[model samples]
Target: MKLHGTVPVMLLPFRADESIDEAPFRKQVDFAIEAGAVAVCAPGFATEFYKLSDPERYWVAKTLVEQTARRVPAFVSTGCGSAHATIEFSQYAESMGADGLMVVAPKWCALGVKELTAFYEAVCRSVKIPVMLQDADFTGAGLPAKLFVELAERCPNFRFAKLEVLLPGSKCAEIIHLSGGKLQVLYGLGGVAMMDGLAHGATGMIPGSALVEVYAKIFRLYGAGQVDQARALFHRLLPYLVFALQHLELAVGIEKRVLYRRGVFPSDRLREPTLHLDNDYQKQMDELVDAVIGLVNEVKAATATRG
Candidate 1:
């Protein structure tokens, strides 16, 4: 399937006791689809994949694929620390009907190009569905464009890239150019550089699920040549993106809080080893949400009316 447009990485809803809340989890899936998301993703970094047990991860992948029910693409993040494990999970996701797989290299230690290439090749070869390489290096030194081109040539299923570096425009341009337009690029990093990435030829964005409709509006506006309006709307929401992305754990916590406030989630309970939002941070988050909640509600209403 062609993966494009705003595909939000879903927040895993939890009850006050910290167990996975299945009812709200399914509600979130329906909410994203109703809000105009082209696709939905799960167990991403934003979903706190590291904190989940293996069974929970598999359950999440199964639940997302089942819940999406082919209404839109459901891409599962299956990047384990070992190539063997990654391939195992990828196969499982494919069997569970995931439309695609998003794989990130092991972040515990830096692997050379040869090792990384081998790892990705094995994964692409293992699954029949398309694979999206997630270049999530916070240091901004992501894998080389040459490696991406070579992988695309070698693995016919390696058709997409999710660029999550510090600044992704240049890398997006380089990869698209090098891959002869065969590799579709999507931008992450909470869609902070979304406008820039679009200007550089990114096909889509994978942002958090709290504001899927808002991002969809910005994307549609830009695609319709309403650049100025898109810019204005994106700028209005930039502060919240910047605030939430200050840290990974902070992003997860804040996004859950936003979902809770929106009534998509019943509670904003995060798993352990999480960054607790202090009172000052909570106050600031409340203020930022206050600034954008109206726009969010407006977009949701318009989308529902159109649908």
Candidate 2:
């Protein structure tokens, strides 16, 4: 089946000290469903997949699927930095009842396209569930759009791709041109490019900002056919989007902190080695949040003025 519709790249919840907060995690899933995500993803790049242990990963997937209760599709990130681990995660995830799998290119190895294809092929063949590709920077993961077209043709289970082609140009155009009305493209980076990405054929977006009411409206407005409204909202959220994208070190913390502050979860805890923001970053992050709120207020005022 083709990847279609709006799906939120769900974030995992954690307690104050950074342990898995299962109760709030499950609640976040329910909130996402309530907010109208047709499908949900677990422990992907946004969910801090790398920090999760095998057992913890399975626990989160099982919890999310259970909470979703077959209400919609549930996808879990199965790609570890290792192919062997990825195969294992895929098997465990499916056995635990995930609706599908989101596999990323091996980051630590910095695999080339060939290695990426081999890794995906191995994981897909090992599982009965459908799998999609998530391409990004250090993973050496961005496959040419043509290669994906071929993969979509060759791999029966290759259902979708989260194209994080950060740069704009021919490759982005190529993905749009070659999607062939087949694989559903998700706009991986969450910002102004979102509207353009959809115009280019990305049916969905894996944005953590979806957890935020205003940001989600930016996406929902577009999906609901209010193009100008959506563009207006996108610009409003652009500052936060840039903050999240620019501060690579603190991106995960930013999402977690924002969600925690919004009461989406119990705490903004990240697992060990993925520490929380420092006082300086936290101070800046606080200002960023203020700026986002200011922007939202400005948009609300502008919208009223337009009315």
**Which portions of model 2 show Cα errors greater than 4 Å?**
1-6, 138-141, 168-173, 209-212, 223-225, 274-280, 290-307
**Displacement of the residue 98 alpha carbon in candidate 1, Å:** 1.0
**What is the lDDT of every predicted structure here?**
0.90, 0.71
lDDT of 2 by residue, 37-59 (tens): 66888877777777777787778
TM per candidate comes to 0.97, 0.85
Using TM-score as the measure, the top candidate is 1
Clashing pairs in 2: none
Clashing residue pair totals per candidate (backbone < 3 A): 0, 0
For model 2, give the 10-residue run with minimal summed lDDT: 209-218
TM-score of candidate 1 to 2 decimals: 0.97
Model 1 stretches astray by more than 4 angstroms: 301-307
